[model samples]
Every structure is written in C-alpha cells, then in structure tokens.
Target: MARPRKPLLSRARIVAAAAALVDAEGLEAVSTRRLAAGLGVSGPSLYNHFRTKDEILEAVADAVSAQVDLSMFDESDARDWRTALHDWALSYRAALTDHPNIVPVLARGPGRRPAGLRVADAVFGAMVRAGWPPAQATYIGALMRYFITGSALGSFARGFVDDETAYDPADYPHLGQAHLLAERREKVDEGAFETGLRALLDGLALQYAAVVPDAHAAAGTER
Candidate 1:
C-alpha cells in the first residue's frame, strides 16, 4: 500500500511555532518531538524541514533578525557617527528585548547562524558609513552587542528573581535600594533602557574616537 505524502509544512510556520513555544514555555520546552506534537505531526516530520534543533533556533533567530529596520540607518545620512550608532543600537536592542525568551540565546552560539551575521552587518554598516575604520567598527559592534546583551540579561533577571525570592529591604541595603528603583521605575521600562543604552553608546563612541583618530578625522573631513 502506498502511503500518502504528508502535506508540506512551511519553514516560516515551523520557526514561528518554535518561537511561540519558547515564549510560552521557556527554551527547555522546545524539542523536535514537542514541536511536532504542537504542530500535529510526528517527530520525523520536523527533520524534513529542520535538520536539527539548532537549525530551528537559527531559523527563529533569522526571523527575529528580520524584525530590525535596516532602512532606518541611511548610508547617506548626514547625521554624526554617534547619532547613527545610537539609532542602530537602539533598534537592535529593542528587537532583542522584544524577544526576551531568545535574548539570552543571542549571547550564546548564534555565532554560526547567518541571522546573527545580519546583526553584525547592520552594526558594521552603520559604523563604516560614518567613516569608522574596519577594526574600530568591529570593536564597536562587539562591544555594543556584549553590553546590550549583558544589560538585558540583568534587567530580565529581576523578573525571575521576583518570582523566586522573598526579598527584604532590611538584609540587603544596596540590592534593596536597586530593587526599589526597579519597582518605582522598572528596569525594562523605556527610561531605563534609554539610560543604559545611552551610557554604553557614549563610552563606546569615546573609546573608538580616541583609538581611531584617523578614522574620526576622516569623518570630520567628510562632513
């Protein structure tokens, strides 16, 4: 007896389902079997679309990367380097934070993923367009990514901590004070994000400017 061919499941749908699973029930809940169950198919069916779980993650990351508005940073913009860098960084951070379940994964081995490379390309594009040298642009991209991920992780931790811990102001003054700040003006809020992002961008711009004097000079000359 000939078996009927299984209907095609779109790659976009699979990745979107995986992303939804991660959002609903953390990354640990995502597996080939589980996703298949969610998708009304058998485990083997997923392998037809995604070679491995990592591939699925890569696809999901690519979907997330697509959320960034690359057009916002014009290659021909007359804005200064810091302004351009600020625009790029803010957009990148916003996209990452919107996918909180996946933000931590960004710090991990998306190194081999093309979607991850898209992010790097955007950062490099912004810097290069602003007359930054290749080396400095690379440094700025790495620095900004690291800092943004680190800050996001810290802010994200507060939510998990609140759910798990019985925090008291009396025992830990500084932590309590910080918690109070978060409570009154949340870490994940726009103000906190703007402040953290601005501070990091400021430091990065300063360092890149100092070490890449020739590049800075060229930027000024171009203007």
Candidate 2:
C-alpha cells in the first residue's frame, strides 16, 4: 500500500491525546497503552515520539503554558510594571484555570519546558527592566507562580457544600451563608482572584517605591 499522507503518530498527536485524557479523566488516567489505543496505533509506536508517559505529560503542561498571553511584557509597551504584572497574573491564572488538571505538573516549576521557561523569563526580565533588583525580580516570578497555581488547584467557593444545612449556625456562626457560595462559584472565585491580584500589586507598588525611589513618579508620568 502507498505511504499514508499523514504520519499515523507524531509528538504533537501524542501530546494532544494525552492532554485530552488528562482533561477528561485527571492525570492518573494517562498511560502509553491507553494513549496508543486512543490513537489507533500499537503501544510501542508512541515510544517513537515520547520515551515515557512522564515526558508526554510534560509536553501537555507546556502546551497549556503556551496559551498564556505575554504581550503585556513587550518592551515597547510603556505600561508600568505594576500594570503589566497585574495583567500577566490575570492571564496566567486564566490559563491555569482552564487546565486545572495539569496545574499539578506545572506547579513543579518550568522544568526545562520551552514555553514555561518563556513565562518565567518574561516575568523576570520585565521586572528587572522596570527597575526591580535582580533578586526581587526572581522573587516576583516565584511568588506569582505560587499564587496562580494555588488558585487553580481548586475552587474555594465550591469547597462549601451546596446544602444550606452544611453550615449550622450553632457550629459555624460566621458561615451563615456559606452554602450560597457554591451556587455563585464563578463570581466568588473570580472576585477573590481579582481582589488578591490587586492587593499583591498594591503591595508590590509600595515596595517598588522603596527600591526605586523615583519609580512611582515615573510610573505616574507614564500613565
């Protein structure tokens, strides 16, 4: 028979299938045999593209990282670091939120993933260019990663059971309306994220002033 126009299996195809499995059934559901079966190929064929399942999961995580928007870090953009950081955090959280199943692997840090490295590099480079000391810039990158990933790990509002009786006034006096939160999970979660992001940026702005005495004034002028 003639060679197929498209190769039956490739790295991209493997990563995509693995990612879909993860998204639908959590990380533990992915295995080379299952992935090959899903791809309609022999199990060993997947090894031609990926040596192991761990490597495939890493690629899936990196694919999620690539979805984040880093345009706010553009050198030509005159926005202050605070604004840029705020926008970047929002974008980062969004990507994580969409792929909550992969957040665990991503929380392990970039781990030599190309797209993940770009995210870290962009945040650190932008902070340094914005006049933050190198050490502080590094801290900012780590801090943002921790916050964004933690937020994506689970939904706070959904933590509360939807049954109104779950929060008894006798046992939990302050949680009178706690059960209502699950019904408004999206709004509550988003509001919490925004509130936390603003608080972080506001605190960072104060620190920026102390580190770069004229940064506040310059930022004001730019705005």
Candidate 3:
C-alpha cells in the first residue's frame, strides 16, 4: 500500500506513533516495523530520527511523563511538601492510568528522559526543601511511586470475578459476596488511594517534623 502524504517523518512523529501503537496494542507490539507502518513511513526512515527502537521508546516514556502535573511542586508551593507530594502522586497515577501499557517502563526509572527528569527534580527538590533528609526524601519518592503504580495495576476494590458461584462459600466465607462490591469498585479504589495517601503523608509529616524541628518552628507550619 502507498503511504499517505503528510508531514515529513521526524522524531516527534516517530515517538508519537510508537506511543499510539503501544496504547492500541501493547508494549511488545511497538516494533520498528509497527511504528513505521503507523507513521506511514519506511522502516529505515525511522533511524534518521532514532538509531534504535529503544531510543524511540525512551521518547515515548518521556511523552507520558510530560502529562504528569508536577506543577504542584513549583516555587509557589515548594514548602508545602505534604500537599505538593499528594497532588503529584494523584497526577502521576492519573497520567499512568491513561497509558497503562507504559506504566511498567516508567516505574523501572526514567532513564535520563527530559520530561521524566523534570518530574524527579521537582519531587525530590520539594521534599528536601521542606526539610526531609535527602535519604528519607528519596525513600518517600520511591514509596509514593510504588503505591501509585501498584494502584494503577489493578482494582483493589474489584476482588476476584463478578460471578456469584465463582467461589465456594465452604472454602472461602468472606469472599463469597465479593462481587457485590464490584459495582462500586471505582469508589473503593478512589477511597483507598485517598486514604493511603493521607496516611502516608501524615506519617511522613511526622518524620519531616522530627528531621527539621528548627525549620518547622521558624515557618510555624503545623502540617
């Protein structure tokens, strides 16, 4: 089939095509051949923009990262670490939810991608500026990511299948009516995210207070 006429192939086009392919199919489906076809270009043409498929995928991952709203940690709110981190986690989860296929790649680490580095810089800087010890702040960042990414994986509220007879009451008592909760599965998931975020932030707030009592005293903040 003859390729369509449009904008010439470029790095942006390659990365966008790759991301779309992954979204439509899966990560495994995003090959050079697949990306070329999606972009209406020859396979070799892609190399002009990216030498290897991995480079293209790195761009794709950064594209996904670009969607996350790290503005919460901007200069205006840098000192309010609790709110900033909480908002960032929510935004991160929402962005990953849009590209479920890309979440694993992002969770592994951002691999020097520009947009991903910005997110890391914003998050880590905010935590440290708010007086969390550097090591502790790093751990908190990892912890929030683990929670958000795990939440993105599956529904904690949607336990098991919705079939009433799927589970034998004799074998499992409490899980028998589990399907009933599936109807409100989304609410359950949202509630869990909020509850967990609050608990995690509250715990971290205590640690932050302990680490920099002088800062807290000077700021007169009760977070």
Candidate 4:
C-alpha cells in the first residue's frame, strides 16, 4: 500500500512554495503541477487551498508584500520627515529588488490585500505624524508608491537589454547624456529613486511645515 500523505498543506505554505519557485526561476515556472511537485504533493492537494493558479499567484504576491518590514518608521525620529520617508522608500526598493521576478506581478494589482493596505497606512501615518493633513498624506503616499514601484520595475526590466545598443544621440541629447552617466555609475545603484523620493518628501514637508508658523519661525532662528 502507498504511504498516507501529510495533511499539512495550507494556503500559506502553497503561496510560500510558489514564491520560492518564482524567486529561483521566473514567474513562468509557477504552474499548479510545478508547485505541487515542488511541495512533494499531488496537484489536487493545492486545489484544497487555492482554486486556480491565479489564486495561488495572488496569494504569493500577498505573501511577498507581507514580508516588507515597517518597524523603523514606528518611532518618532529627530530627523525630518523627508529623511524618514527617503529611508522608507529606499528600504522598500531594496525589498523589491530581492524578488525581481515577482515585482511585475506585484506592480500589476495587489492593491486590495491586507498587507498592501498596511503598507499604505504606514506611509500615510508617517506623513500624518509629520503634520500633513489627511488628504495630502494619503495622496502623497499613493504617488510615492507609484513612482517608486514603476521606476524599480522599469530599471529591473531594462537590465535584460544589451549594453551597447546604438541610438541617435543628436535627436535626444539629454537622454544620451543620461545614458553616459548611467554607464559610469553602478547598474544597481538606486540614486534615481533616492533623489526623487527626497525631492518629493522635501516639498511635502515644506508645504506642511508652513502650517506651523511658530515652529517655522523657531527653525529659521536656529538656522
């Protein structure tokens, strides 16, 4: 007789296995049979947790989103909100780079998951704590998410392209200049992300800090 199977399969474990597969291979390798085989189980076993591969993929995306750590933003920092926000965005970019294959899936739509909401709340909460109005905080946080995620996906995808492609430098002189700078710098360096994040956060901080004239006056005197 065949040995009995372990009844330990759960949605979480299935998603984890799928994420691991995608991390090792690309997203194309994360089919139902592949996942089941990877877990040393039958295909039907996964059906017990997820109805379809899409569901499994969704779960995996959620699992990855859940992995982002936001503890550093929990306490009040003596640094300005611009510094704090830049750190948060940089940390988020680092986490995204660790799992490039799944970042595209995440970039598509994981917006409604609990983990996704928590990340939004954390960012908005930081802005709120820094004296931004509710509306401004929410808007800026969402904008920051779009900017950071889109930039990361674009940069990672471009890594597959050839380094020596010829282009008409005369037609797009600025882009050619940027290409030169890009070639000189490290490929994985996130200077663009950091620069953009700091500039936007600084603008937001300045706008919000204006509401506190007394604080601004005191800060000016110190400066």
Q: What C-alpha lDDT do the candidate models reach, one value each?
A: 0.70, 0.90, 0.81, 0.70
Best-performing candidate as measured by lDDT? 2
lDDT tens digits by residue: candidate 3, 1-223: 9775788888887888789888888789888987888777788998887999888878898999999997788778544777777778888988987898887788788778999898888888887777778998799878887898888877776776778888788988978777777888877888899899888877777666678887763342333
Report the C-alpha lDDT of model 2 over 99-212, residue by residue, as the tens digit: 899999999999999999999999999999988999999999998998899999999999999998888899999999999999999999999999998888777777887889
Output the number of the TM-score-best candidate.
Answer: 2
lDDT order of candidates, best first? 2, 3, 1, 4
Residues forming the 10-long window of minimal summed lDDT in candidate 2: 214-223
Q: RMSD per prediction, one decimal?
A: 4.7, 1.9, 3.2, 4.3
Return the TM-score for each candidate structure: 0.77, 0.95, 0.89, 0.76
Scanning candidate 4 in windows of ten residues, the lowest lDDT window is: 214-223
Clashing pairs in 1: none
A best-first ranking of the candidates according to their TM-score comes to 2, 3, 1, 4
State the lDDT of candidate 1 residue by residue for 1-223, as single tens digits. Answer: 9765865677877898999988778788889888888878888988888899978877887777777766646666676667666676677777777787777677773576776787778778877876677888888778777876776565643553432135555775556434344454354565677787777666666666676676664343221
Clashes of 4: 0
Please give the range of 10 consecutive residues that has the lowest summed lDDT in model 1: 156-165
Backbone clashes for every candidate come to 0, 0, 0, 0
